[model samples]
Target: MPEQTTAAQTARADIPADGAGKPDAVVVRDALGVGIAVGLSGFAFGVTSAGSGLTVWQTCALSLLVFTGASQFALVGALAAGGNPLTAAAGAFFLGVRNAFYGLRLSQLLALPRVLRPFAAHWVIDETTAVSLAQPGRRAARIGFAVTGLSLYLLWNLTTLVGALGAEAIGDTDAWGLDAAGPAVFLALLAPMLKTGVDRAVAGLAVLLGLGLLPFLPAGVPVLLAALAAPAVLYVAGRRRGAGRGGTR
Candidate 1:
């Protein structure tokens, strides 16, 4: 009886608390949705990179190796503006550093096998992290992370190749507004998650800081500065709560 009970408990633990149909299937569907939507934006990166004087191979290599949209765009955009290669690389490096923080959180959530950790670390980008953390259980999180990563990686690389090859025919990617696609999808995903006052405060302040500093700072530096919004908002909120408790006494 104890054996049967343990087996039943283990099986139930794998299911999502929301009971949203087959949890694995639901996770895959959602992950694929995010993956396909954001992955297509790789076309813009390819076109922009090629237009910025990169060869087709160079553009494709960036997409394949870096796999981070914001960093790739920042590097190419800075180069297009006549920035030094070293400086451009530095800015891109700063933009991609956020992925390391994402990996720290996802390592606990996914808890993948040691053999898979290195490979999984490569896919720890904004979209995959968002999809994995949205899931209710570890099983669902793993499925979401794997599906989102695989689909986005494949589609992004494929579209990047096509875009790089057809850069001349495309003329200017900005005119087509393809550059906005990734951010649009990201905001759509993030909008639903801002369910609390602190979440909204951090997001609002981040936007303000990012946009406000855009004209004054270098490309990726504004984003790095905006990251301060989280800690600033949290500190203020913590002080406010403490003061309220003291007032109640």
Candidate 2:
């Protein structure tokens, strides 16, 4: 009896803490689900981009290269509104900056070969980051990341081409309410991440700033100004914490 108990303990000890015990098939399924759902939104982008006066190739190129949905939407949305290209690009650049931070965290989690890092960096967008981080173990994380990235990349580009080509047949894309697809998908992904009070506060403030400034400011400028919401919320939170500590002391 004691021998059996000891062996069981040893087996449990050998298991990975991060839930590496999860089957590869399960991880792949979850990753694919996220990838396919988000990738379909690329149709909206392609249609919107083409309707905004971009050529079919240009719409496809943005999906292929820029890849990040929120940033791409912001750029095209601004341009469609007659904003300056430079300002639109700047807003999109600021939005894409978050992916760099995602890559930093993913670098530690993934630990891919040096040769693969550059290629993998392109896939370190929101959906891939979310799926990878949700996995229980390093191996699972890699699987999730790779599957999500590949599926989303392929589908997004493919759908973008179809949407751009069909844009004329679809008539006014905005009338179909397709323009909201990218942001709706993005918000769905983001809503889960605002798990804390601080996170929620920051998001709320960002929404307020973006909406409040939208009428007065140029198209992309509101987005740029809304980026200040994080620092503003953090500063206030920090001061409150300091004050609470002083009172406690």
Candidate 3:
């Protein structure tokens, strides 16, 4: 017990006092900013879906319930192309499966209150996960998660309504340059988080794989393909390290 206590004390000492390792404010700021920026892109979705034959109510429903940008876009786009609804739903389902992986990482990290976690699960998309994980501590992570999720949900729905109502006059949301804002903001936040060479490599590989597969594969398949690159790289790296150590032995 004494030895365990001493080890615990040493670990605590290693952590920098007052967040010398990570700043809390910066994480919160990034989360809020990213959420708003991404939420704004819902305007584009609203217009796009309306143009694609979705009613204003239907578009708003998707923004409210589906909540995931990529999957919602995939579903609408597929249906617009006259694809079967079940097939479209399946594609969207595959796209959303990535969030479950995010939830796995988060559940272990945040350890949120039971009352809050189920509600929080609805917000476990790309932006929230990125912002929360960027935080250095549990408190910051929870704040980041809640702020991003709430901000995105509210703003996305509002913008969706605006775009749906003004779909004809608004013309192309892409032409106004709103289309790229969310992804650009997300990438900017994510870039700083890729501190290690291995992390950068994994990100680069995922990007390459995802974009490369996008034109040929279905909408969600590219995301899944990109997801594979990180684990595959890690496995290969581990094997190489083992082989090098075995050779040295």
Whole-model lDDT, model 1: 0.84
Per-residue lDDT of 180-232 in model 2, one digit per residue for the tens? 99989989989999999999999999999999999998989999999999999
Candidate that beats the other on TM-score, 1 or 3, i.e. the better one: 1
Ranking by TM-score: 2, 1, 3
| Segments of candidate 3 deviating more than 4 angstroms | 1-31, 77-88, 134-136, 172-186, 213-227
* Candidate 2: segments with Cα more than 4 A from true spot: 1-19
Q: Please tell me which model should have the higher TM-score, number 2 or number 3.
A: 2
- Cα deviation in Å at residue 176, candidate 2? 0.7
Best by lDDT: 2
Specify the highest-TM-score model's number. Answer: 2
Instruction: Give the whole-model CA lDDT for all candidates, comma-separated.
Output: 0.84, 0.91, 0.78
For residues 1-249, could you state the per-residue lDDT of candidate 1 as single tens digits?
445566546655554544244467888999999899888888887888888899999999998899998888878877876767876787788878989999988876776789999999989999999988888877788889999999999999999998888899988777886666656665776799899999999999999997898788765566667778999999999999999999999
Q: 1-249 in candidate 3: lDDT tens per residue?
A: 444556545544533223345567776687789888889888877887886788999999999988998778777766765666776787678768879999988876677779988888999998899887777767777778888999999999999999889888977654675444445655665687799878988998988997898688754556556777788889988999899999998
RMSD of each: 4.5, 5.9, 4.6
TM-score of each: 0.81, 0.92, 0.71
Give the Å shift of residue 156 in candidate 3: 1.2
Give the Cα-based TM-score of candidate 1 against the true structure. Answer: 0.81
- What's the lDDT of the predicted structure labeled candidate 3? 0.78
